[model samples]
Target: MIKVLLNGCSGKMGEVVVNASKNFPNIEIVAGIDKFPTEKYNFKVFKNTSDVDIYYDVLIDFSRPEALVDLLNFSVKNNKPIILCSTGYSDEDLKLIKEKSNIIPIFKSANMSLGINLINSLLKKIVPNLYENYDIEIIEKHHNQKVDSPSGTAILLADTIKNSLPIESKYVFGRDGFSKREKNEIGIHAVRGGSIVGEHDIIFAGSGEIIELSHTALSREVFAVGALKAAEYMADMFYPRIYNMEDLLGI
Candidate 1:
């Protein structure tokens, strides 16, 4: 079994990952690092990565941005692969992550759901066909407890669609005041509600017709399963590099 050090193993998504691990027999969470460690996991928990000395094949970080620095340090010191599944990072944070990728193999993706990534690739082809004739807007809904608005996945989707367009496009977040929709803009709107696992809708409005491409996640298992797959993939890799869902999917 590939031993994994699970970071942020006490939070909601962390709990989901723990529960979903049973389905992946090849991966085993040997340890966890969380601020609030609990006995719920069969493996031992550490308050910080620095304190742990276990032999883990990979480190799967679903923790907050604050924990990133320590996790990278731990990864570098141990020469281990890391699967980053966290969202909400600043430009500086991303730069730091990129720098750290030179030291260890890092797999990072805004959305770990394979369906979302497949849609991302599909949109690369789909956007070019429709961007000129239609106005596009994305609506993403998640649970209220989730931080970060206009989710990382929303940005990822928006960027994916923009890169595919022939002409330059601008991104517009939730608009409240009446402003005319511009032709060169893609609007992304986020909604927070009760216990919504995840939902994304890409709507294209044309002269007299409409088309919508959507994905709804009923459970967090999608992300958990994807992350586990990534960890196993990374553990087998020996080189220092950055990876994503596209790499994992060979797309």
Candidate 2:
């Protein structure tokens, strides 16, 4: 069995992952790391990642950004593969993750659903060719408690689309007073309400035609399942490399 350590086990997504692990017979979660130790689940919870003693084959993190450095440090020190499912990492934090990949196998994704990663790859191919004629916009929605605005996934989509263009593209998060959409701008909008799991839509508007691509996540288990698959894949792989859902899915 692939021993697993779950970070942020008390959080919403973490709880989902905990339950989802039961479906994978080859994966077992031996321990969990969380700031709050409320007795909602059956797993032994550690207040910090350093307190865990059992040999974990891989560490899956769905925690907050504030706790990422400590988690990354612990994973690197123990030489365990890490799958970072957490969102809202700053550019510097990403740089740190990239640097640490040299020492351990690191898998990071803003969104873990295989479909989303496929969409990202598709956008990379379609965006550049349609740049001159198409106007692009991205809108995403998540649970009300999500801390990040526009979301890391939205930025990932935007960045992928931007990379396809020869000229630099601008990101417009919101419109305030007197501001109009620029010709080279990629509009990104975020919606937070209710108990929605997640939703992302990309709109390509042109002369008389409109193309819309969307993905809706009904449950968090999709992400959990993907993360578990990533953990199993990384267990036997060599370290010092960064991977995403696409790499895990082999697409």
Candidate 3:
């Protein structure tokens, strides 16, 4: 079995992961780390990485970006692989992740759902064929309690589309005071409402026709399942490098 040390154990996603782990008998969450650390779990919970004394094959984080440093430190110190599922990481934090990846295996993904990752792969293939004539826009919605705006998954999709475009395109978050939509602009909009698991829509508009691709996450279990799969994959990754869904799915 792959023993996992789950980060952000008290959070919503963490709870989802705990419940999802039951479906994967080979993956076991032996311990957890949470700032609050008040919730009762079947496994041991620690307030910080320093307080952890349990044995785990890998660390799976669904925590906040603020916990990145401590988590990375703990992973490196213990020579354990880590899977980072947190979003909204700053550029500096990304750099740090990449830096630490040179010493220990680090798996990171803004969104872990298989459908979302498949959409990312699809955009790479589909965007290049239509970007020249199609004006693109991305709409993403999440729960009100979500901390970040224009979620990491939204950015990931936008970045994928941008890379596939031949012409230089810039991102426009929202069109509040904008007079007109520029030809080389990719619009991104964020919507927050009540208890939305997640929703993403990618729109491509042309002279007379429009095309849309979308993915709706019915529940958080999709992500939890993917993260657990990542944990199982990372369990034996002794090499030092950064991995992602592409690596996990072999796409």
Query: What clash pairs does model 2 have?
Result: none
Model 2's TM-score against the true structure: 0.96
**Candidate 2 local distance difference test against the native:** 0.89
Candidates ranked by lDDT: 3, 1, 2
Q: Report the lDDT tens digits of candidate 1 across residue range 1-251.
A: 99988999999889989888888889899999999989988999999777897898998988788888888888898888999999898898899899998988999999999999999999988888898899999999999998898899999999999889889889999887888889999999999999999999999999999999899998999999999999878988879889999999999
Flag regions of model 1 displaced more than 4 Å. none
Q: Residues 20-127, candidate 2: write the lDDT tens digits.
A: 999999999888888897577776888977688778788999988888788889988888889999889988999999899899889999999988999999998888
Residue 196 lDDT in candidate 3: 97
C-alpha lDDT score of every prediction, in listed order: 0.91, 0.89, 0.94
Structural similarity to truth (TM-score) of each candidate: 0.97, 0.96, 0.98
RMSD of each: 1.0, 1.2, 0.9
Model 2: per-residue Cα lDDT at residue 76: 82
Residue-level lDDT of model 3, residues 1-251, one tens digit each, is 98999999898899999999999989888999898884578888998888999999999999889999999999999999999999999999999999999999999999999999999999999998998788999999999999999999999999999999888989999889848999999999999999999999999999999999999999999999999999989999999999999999999
